[model samples]
Target: MSDLDLGVIGNCAVAALVDRDARVVWYCLPRFDGDPVFHALLGAPKDAPDDGVFAIELEDHVHSEQHYIENTAVLVTELHGRQGSLRITDFAPRFVWRDRLFYPQALVRRLTPISGSPRIKIRLRPRFEYGSVAPARTYGSHHIRYVGPQTTMRLTTDATIDFIRDETFFNLSAPLDLFLGPDETLQLGVKETADRLEERTLVYWRTWTHRLATPFEWQDAVIRAAITLKLCTYEPTGAIVAALTTSIPESPGTQRNWDYRFCWLRDAYFVVRALNRLAAVRKMENYFRWLMNIVASLHENDIQPVYGIGLENKLIEREIPDLPGYRGMGPVRVGNQAYEHLQYDNYGNVILGVAQMFLDRRLLSPPNRADFQHLEALGRRALKFYDQPDAGMWEYRTRASVHTTSSLMCWAAADRLARIALHIGETQRASEWRASADRIREVILERSWSKKRQAFVDSFEGEYLDAGVLLMTEVDFIDPRDPRMVSTVKQLEKVLGRGPHMMRYEAADDFGAPGTAFNTCSFWRIDALARMGRVEEAREYFSELLKLRNRLGMMSEDVDTKSGEMWGNYPQTYSLVGIVNCAVRLSRPWEAII
Candidate 1:
């Protein structure tokens, strides 16, 4: 009976999700794709003592409220009991230290009594290797160390150790501080350190949000979405995760969940594009370095659709059978299978992700001819695979067909390469790439378009309607105002649109037809609607779609149109980025506001 009523706190190195009652339910140790140290979000077995959680439970708890501390990743939760009330402040410290970015792999919590005498229990359960190992514990006067085979975690706190260890409620007279992170002694007292880190982290986040060039309208919502998007970034490697937790189902009573901790090449681009719209250049630059490392490491033209944050290419798909999933949906997967699939659109996405680096004068390191040469290799692969496909962007498990989205991305790769070549004064190379782009575009227009149905279908020589065809205008493959493009949008609306939602597609895939509407696709629908001169309707749907975000202005991968419950991975980057993009497209100009 668990829900997605969670708020996230992070420092780009590690993140944790805090449930409504201020329990740290989901936390990964050391890094984003690392072991789940606090795994209660994906619960343990039925009647298994509810392991993998760090909870501060108020005795006789009646109701609670949770929210972020304005324009920051810091979260505050209030618990009200019959006797008294207390406030819980949670955040992972992030700030500049020693003239460098200091984001440790840690989470900090502060408990302050608000009213009359309040008693609370501390439940700190740290699991290892996906809930297979329960670590042995050792304690000092002020800290407890959890030692396991894979990792050792420490909790340094000012609270009573016996009360925490024995799960007994204790009277709260003064504020308490708990710092859970690597097994290390605090340089200072827990209270002073937590307070200092909280203040620094607050300043850091406010400064970060202050710099964002958000649209005047929906300023608060846009800022929250942008901050969440920033939290999903693994700063050391510049890899942005699709979501924080794994195995959150796409809908109720379904096994449609997959681990989303890894960085997908396609998804990373969209995230970068969204941040770039707000003039946030650090993520783009760091991600460009990450992207170049991946490109440089490829001995051949081969690239994966997803990889570990550190750029490790081998992401073998597997399931941890022992760990029960979100709300007891089992089969908690670790690695992703999409890494093995040939998602052709990734080629274009890669080039598009870094294409601006060549032209943006603000970049510290600009692309040189050598980089273009390597990209030419990718363009050749694009040309070779534009008309062929192994998996579409949706990652169909059992089928492989020539998808229109694949061809469009390949065309995008060539098209961007041509522009890059022109910018670098390589007319000959530009002409060649332009020709490649033109040839690919012709085939896409010829094979993907359906004459009888008057719309572009999902695959070549196929009559199935899909929301993916709406990307034709997104990548500039077709004008949004074109008659053919207009008809395709109309057809998709009839076939896939549900109220303000839009399904990924109507046709059955390896997992039968999708039930929850893909939230990202619905944003894509808004863009199409606006571009096709349906501005008022587009604005209305955009406003409606904003309601699907959780109380913290966070979104997921999919949403049930009828019930309005968000599903899929929590705080999905695809859905979050859609908010920024749609806002930019639909917002009134700054000139008008000024």
Candidate 2:
């Protein structure tokens, strides 16, 4: 393997392998939610001719393989060729420094040749505002100033980086350095005589991993997944993006492209549950604090399904006319329009997650009583519009149906509100919320279940089997062993399970076409199996899903089982969380069926 044929996708961000060389051929810097600064995964250089911003051409390349560190966020790509074998480690340091948050701003690509000397290429392209604004570069011996609107990136290199027109590219045989200034001045340095960057990277990763308090047997994998999850989390706002890049079609050349880098309230409960399972209290605390801020800032009726990093509620969707999409998929987009769509299920998800946080005895400090009260007020207001049709979890194109998932979430909200009232000693409020929750549950059970199908339907009157119903087990709305649950799982397996991977639903009905199998849904099935006392089946399915992880132990949003190509966004947080959660569940002895 002389060529670096690697790719990474997560939180809607997609990156491609340039070659065996350590250089990142494709990457959108600053944030995954941001537009592309480097986009080569979509197609050849011709499609995005004018939009071509940053391109690195490496020298003395060899063999390379990408892998995540044992239990941390660091990504390592080992390269070996005619000159020597060098290890390049990439990571965004986590520990807070001087009251300034140090996240994934600086792309730390560490290179150490094991044997003979090998030259490498380095390129720097700082295109602000999604390659729309080209910055003027002023070069110094060790510094390069990239001036853009409201942001400046001071690129500092240990080895001289040759400045190209609107880009920077360099070839080096020794240590190299670079810096990326997003909002503030950033410094990067490499020295002949200095502490090992690898050692420091290991120290940073191991120290962080040790903070996890869970003693689960699958701690290694779980810790790695947790670290990935943390890396995906936007530290400033406590929002975890769905994936790093967008526009990677679920089916090649299909119209299933979606931007997932925004914060989704529907992911709230799952994120909290996974973090709590790992005993990661600090993360949950930060997330809840962010949630509180969102609730406090918005009026009850103005709540959106998602928000931008700065807590901006409006995400007007638009296409970047310049750049072509990944693998020729057209219409590359940013700023999710779905935020404007009514996603009623988010209310339930938020309430459920907050309630879970309250239930956890590990809450470092008691939540503010006022915050809880405000949350309750929001829930009550949302209930007024709960009967209205809105986009469901899939965020479909046509008018929203009576989505079973959304309705279930409504029940979840009411149930959690009742729990919240009980927690804070509000007996009267507790009784009222409890009654409301019971009513909602009754309505769901009566209206959502299809007698003809013998299982819960996707909506009030539809007979389709949606994989989302598996969440019923996760939410505790239905016992895993309930006959309905069994029937639902069986129906999904027959209808949607393609080998080990599962589809969201029968796709022929809406969205024009179905997509490649969704990796998250497959893990959900594994979880459903485990919860239903099918431990053996769960383990089998879980093992198969684990095999789908790329050579780097990372998973994408979907997989083409036929070609074994990982499609959609790379390094999807939901799939990783599902894997970790399911693994944890399966690691335990088979408890009595739920």
Candidate 3:
């Protein structure tokens, strides 16, 4: 049985998920939101013939191992057979070329013989409409064009055309380069183009990693996590996807699957905060631009929690019936209905994302008075909805409550705006925002705390606990050492904690009780513990949580704490954010080593 030990390769334009066996299992072409071109991860049973998978498998396969080149997004998988072994190098070409960045929405696989004579088989099955339609193929001298109903792709390769087309076995004698990209003939031959791309992409990733101001501890883990996060960014639009592939269930058959391919304003705060801490400005700057566009496009009371990467407003949910889901589960979903739901927490997030522009002098073009006026409009919305019932951060489908987390963030928006106003020398506006923040603070303290429970609950006048409340100290809604915060952590640990992993909440959700621990919640636990002066305990728990990452140092959205298997969407941005933030918070100061 395979674990969720998968490797991801992308060029900030597109991404793919490859298993240990070197199969391109899950990929969306042209862009992250485009229809699936390779959709094997949401499968039609492993033994079924022509299951719409893309694999370069060895006929004499024995075993295989997968890993990344150090500090890079490039992935290498070594497959050993009874007779011979082969190495596959997988990446999407992304680098600076001719004074411009060249990042094509393409996947390149280079197969080389390691030892002995290796017999290999090539299977390229590109699907359309979320694996509901198989593409018709037309072949030429050195290329194969796969034409689907809505999309077309071309495969340019150096391998024998007959062998690839027929899926026949061939003995490997030399290198074979396969470039699967948008429907265009390769100007240069496959081998030469692939060689140049491999060299440049390697340099691009290394140079990009070289600029990171990593912590003194866990440098490798941080770098890998940072790269994964970068790959999730859709550079053309500057929107970072929550994850790559979608509907990989939170756990087996729980129906907790969600499409995370779009951009969520709520996630932007944490994503930009993590990148900003590392002094990586490019992602932040790009994301700010994306946000500004969304802000500029917003009408009164029309802001949404989520948007298409292109800022499209509608996302209607539907299932791909032809594709049996990940791990043989059914109902693989396409669009996410959460876009239509009310998630008031987004208003605060929008303000927080822009607040950095006003405060950070490093920004090339910081926010002006006009920018603050737009942001204050969002702040006004947060002020209106902060006390109302709506969907909380978890995006519960069937429930509504005056969620303390949402209210706290409303406070954060007003509080941060006050400081931002001060930075821009607007004393009167600063005072007004400060008054609004204080009013929110008073409301939270009066209504959200449970005198009987001796802790801050998940909602006003409710008795349940949520892992999100652990974020109280994080957003500065409450001091780390405050009695209420400390008590909330204690009570939360007893109720929501499952061993070291923390569930988002124990309350029954749309899918009933959660079957897996949301990985980022545990990271919040680690951060809270660290700030509470429980240094040794925090270090131990943090180390234990790091052990749960997949072999590639990547994490999904959740993990089955009992079986220690990762689930949810692959290479989750929130999970990686937790790693970078925790490492930065817990690592020893540079002065200790210097």
Candidate 4:
């Protein structure tokens, strides 16, 4: 069974997950959401034989250790054996080539001897159509091409091909470079090419991370989270996926699996916002271009909660029955059905995503009056649905309700629009928006708050508590220290807190109650506690939460709070964003340390 104990390597366009033993377990071809080429993470059960993995097994190996190169996507894994130890270096080549950024759909693995002579066997299996068909392969002296119906990849290696082809153990004496990418022959020596790419990629990542305005504390944690979030971005179209793999069950033995490769409007908003906090402005600008496309594609003012990275609209949901899911949980899914559902909070999220365009003068393109007009149209849509029922931010598939978070976001939409209008000299429009925002706020306070509970409820006049209600303080919908906000934080912590983590909500949904704690919600709780002036307490929980990350400092969507194991999707953008937000919020300024 596959687990979240994986390190991520990518160049923003394509990402692959490698397990602790250095098996390239989950890798999608062509793009982030494409066919799974390295599908060992969801391989067929032991009863049925399948080939969808790339692994290097060292004979007599006893233990292994893995970590990412500091502040970079490059991963290093060490395999210890009785005879010797070997080091495997993995990364996707991404650096400035010519004048354009050259981030190909490729992963390069470099293996070298660390100590004595160790024998190793290489297994390269590339599958297609979600692991239903194994690709036919044709080999050259230096490379092997795995040809599938939809895609083909060539693995160029410096190692002897016979050993790889026959899966025979070979004595390791020197380093070998394996480049798996587009079906093309290598122009340069595979060793030289791999080394150059590694050098340049390392330089590229370190250069990128060097520019970040990180906080004084938790610098390493913040950098790792930022890099993880950056890896989730689909650069060609500026769409940030929620997570890399799909149908990783939120909790063991639960069918709450759903595809998360698409660009969730809400998730992308938080992703860009978090990156922006680190002064990684390019991601937000690239994302703004993507968001503008969605805004332009509006028909009848229809808004979707998610879209494909290339802005493809119809995300028809279905299952890939051929491959078992994470931990043999079946029904591995593709295409999220949320695109067809109305998650009303997206209107607010969309506006919030681009609102920075108007305020930040450093961007290549600043918002003009014309842009304000486009945003005003979006504001109209928000007011129209502020009180209407729809699938809230959680995308609760079974029911639609007037969720409090939806209202808070709609209120945020009006409030931000009012602020933008004032900045752009549209005083009349500003006043109108301010009035609209005030009205929405009044309604939320009246309907969402429960006198008996002394805290806000999930939906209007509802009796249940929800961690999402904590968003009220996040968007400035409510003062952080307001009595109601304080009570809401305390109430949510009492109901949803799971040790150091927090569940998304207390109420059960379509799949029944959530078994694992939502990682993002836990981070939000830290922010809320800090905002309420409980810095020491919040810091304690934050430190404990950070410990939940895997060995490589990577987090998933949810956590098995009972066992302190990670669950749900790996490298979740929402959970990562919480790291940035909380770190930035709680970190003392650099001047203080200085």
Taking every candidate in turn, the Cα RMSD to the unseen true structure, in Å, is 1.1, 4.1, 1.4, 1.2
Give the CA lDDT, 0 to 100, for residue 363 in model 1: 83
Between candidates 3 and 4, which one is better according to TM-score? 4
TM-score per prediction, in order, is 0.98, 0.89, 0.98, 0.98
lDDT by residue (1-594, candidate 3, tens digit) is: 334678999999988889999988888867897877777777753344465678988977999989899878999999999989999999999999899889998999999999889999998877777766777899998999999887788999989999999999999899999999889988898999999999999999999999999999999899998999999898888898898877888888878778999999988778888988898878888888889899888868557889889887898888877777777766788889999888888888888776777777787866688888988888998899999998899898898999998999889989999999898899999999999999999999989999888888889998888899888888888789988889989998888888888989867888789888999999999999999998888888889889998888989999888888889988889999999999999999999999
lDDT of 2 at 283: 71
Cα deviation in Å at residue 112, candidate 3? Answer: 0.9
Clashing pairs in 4: none
**Compared with the true structure, what per-residue lDDT tens digits does model 1 show for residues 296-377?**
8886757788989988777887888667787777678888888888888889999999898888898887879999998888
* TM-score of predicted structure 3: 0.98
> Could you tell me which residue pairs clash in candidate 1?
none
Q: lDDT at 80 for candidate 3?
A: 95
Give the candidate order by descending lDDT.
1, 4, 3, 2
Which residue window of length 10 is worst by lDDT in model 3? Answer: 44-53
The models' CA-based lDDT, in order, is 0.89, 0.68, 0.87, 0.89
